[model samples]
Target: MDPNEPIESADSTPESTTNKPQVPPIPTDGTPKKKYVRAVGPNLKKLLYVVFALLALLGANSGYLASIIAMQWYTGETFENFFYFCMFLGHVALGLLLIVPFIVFGVIHMRNAAGRRNRRAVNVGYALFAVSVAVLISGLLLVRAGGFDLKAPTVRSTVYWIHVACPLVAGWLYWLHRLAGPRIKWKVGISYGTVVGATIVGMV
Candidate 1:
């Protein structure tokens, strides 16, 4: 009310002027924030088991076919019925149906590894996936090139060899990947045993 006195603003109170903790401003941009949800441990384990089982079956079938081919080449013994049955099982049943789930689960496993920030696992998983994909494509190409026929000219083609070599490389990579993880000694023994067992089973 005094004519010369300074007028106090309503917002100039001590409470208003007191320093409070500054709250971060909420982002207003339209971009959605990324949330890294970890994959479920049990579910991931199940997925891995499924993937490995499928791989084993597929690998065994391929090995059987390869062994038959090698025997025919080395000893001149033909296994037409066995070869046809294996071709049907491997190409039609496993290749068409099981491969889809194999790739899906494999990708899921790789992504899970990436989410866990396991650099080595992610790298190895991705490498294996890529090589497996290459193997699948080459196998399909081999089939198209008449490699399915024992006497077909395409049996001797580069594509057939590529299909063969890709699987060998993939098997090597798989063993390496397994051995690089925990229980190195156990994995090494298992890897060797698996190779030997598969080879023997195929030969028989």
Candidate 2:
């Protein structure tokens, strides 16, 4: 060591120089350690997975339905009757496949909301979900009224409008809820990346 250099003490550390509290060690004489034994609250991971899955399904349905609508609007349904029929069938099939899971997730969401400290977000989410469900039920009745027919003007005009609007509004509310909730870690981003990659590969 250079003579001009100040001698460093073994007791001193760079970390020790900072202003920090020295937490007192709790007594260990058979005392109840409530802090250590306390429950870590509800695990929200499954809820998040269910939510994102629903969002993905909603997005895919929106894409397919919007494309079909665009084809009809721009091309005047000049596409073959079989093509339109197939598209309608596909949309219904997707909806049917997703509805059960959607309802399940909604129930899970309500349960989670009950325990949520932030009731505002929970209430908003639930309200949006209810609106979405109402729109879906109305749309289903419209379908049944028309004998599973999309050719009817009422089904195309009125039911279609509600079907489009409700999901969009509900999705926006869900996005807001996500933003207001507790922040997730890098794992979520990684999982999303993997899912997207898998979806693209599957599509191709």
Candidate 3:
């Protein structure tokens, strides 16, 4: 090659020099990523089941109360005296009424707890119901053994007043129990309803 010849003669050939076409680099840093959505958990399902169970129980209990009132009306019984005796029997029977709803709810929801650990709410509620039943039975037996007539003229008799007052207290406590709830109002309301229902049965 001539000395003055353009240097392009040596490197101007594209294929002989190994020069490569430029390509943009893929982005790896500072890219906005998509968020993954999580699924709902089981505890929430259990809570929902419990709430539903409570609502069902409440309806059942309200019906039971209405029935007692209706029966009294039908019989033309003295509300102040004979009604108390009838309430005594009715409340004891109420205990028996509660078992079905609770069992149905447990099976429907697949709740396996048995009044243990945090399930104390259910356990305590059930226990109170049982106690109420027992109290009703015993009180009735006491009245029967004493040979005291429920239809006696006086409404303020000692035994009569105690029956009314004791039941009234129990009913109020059960209502408070039903109303007690934390962040989950429905859960608490339903769970607590059983207590009130059982108490009503005991008192009635």
Best by lDDT: 1
Off by over 4 Å in 3: 1-116, 142-162, 176-204
Q: lDDT rank, highest first? A: 1, 2, 3
lDDT of 1 by residue, 1-204 (tens): 898998879868676557776788788997777786554366777866776676666666666676667878999988658655766466546665566766777777666567555567667767877888887776665554444544556654776677668777887777677765655466755785698576757555
lDDT of 1 at 95: 64
lDDT of 2: 0.64
Candidate order by decreasing TM-score: 1, 2, 3
Where in model 2 is the C-alpha error above 4 Å? Answer: 1-58, 75-77, 80-83, 145-156, 182-204
The residue pairs that clash in candidate 1, if any, are none
Task: Provide the lDDT at 48 for model 3.
Answer: 49
* Angstrom error at residue 15, model 1: 37
Q: Which run of 10 residues does model 3 get worst, by summed lDDT?
A: 107-116
- Model 3's TM-score against the true structure: 0.27
Query: lDDT tens digits, residues 30-102, model 2?
Result: 7875442111124445654655675665465456556556777887855436645665666566666666766
Q: TM-score of each candidate?
A: 0.60, 0.57, 0.27
Off by over 4 Å in 1: 1-40, 82-91, 115-118, 144-156, 184-204
RMSD of each: 9.3, 9.3, 15.7
Q: How well is each residue in 121-204 modelled by candidate 3, as lDDT tens digits?
A: 555455545444444444454344356645544642555445444545555545554543234466766766677677657755
lDDT-best of 1 and 2: 1
lDDT winner between 2 and 3, please give it.
2
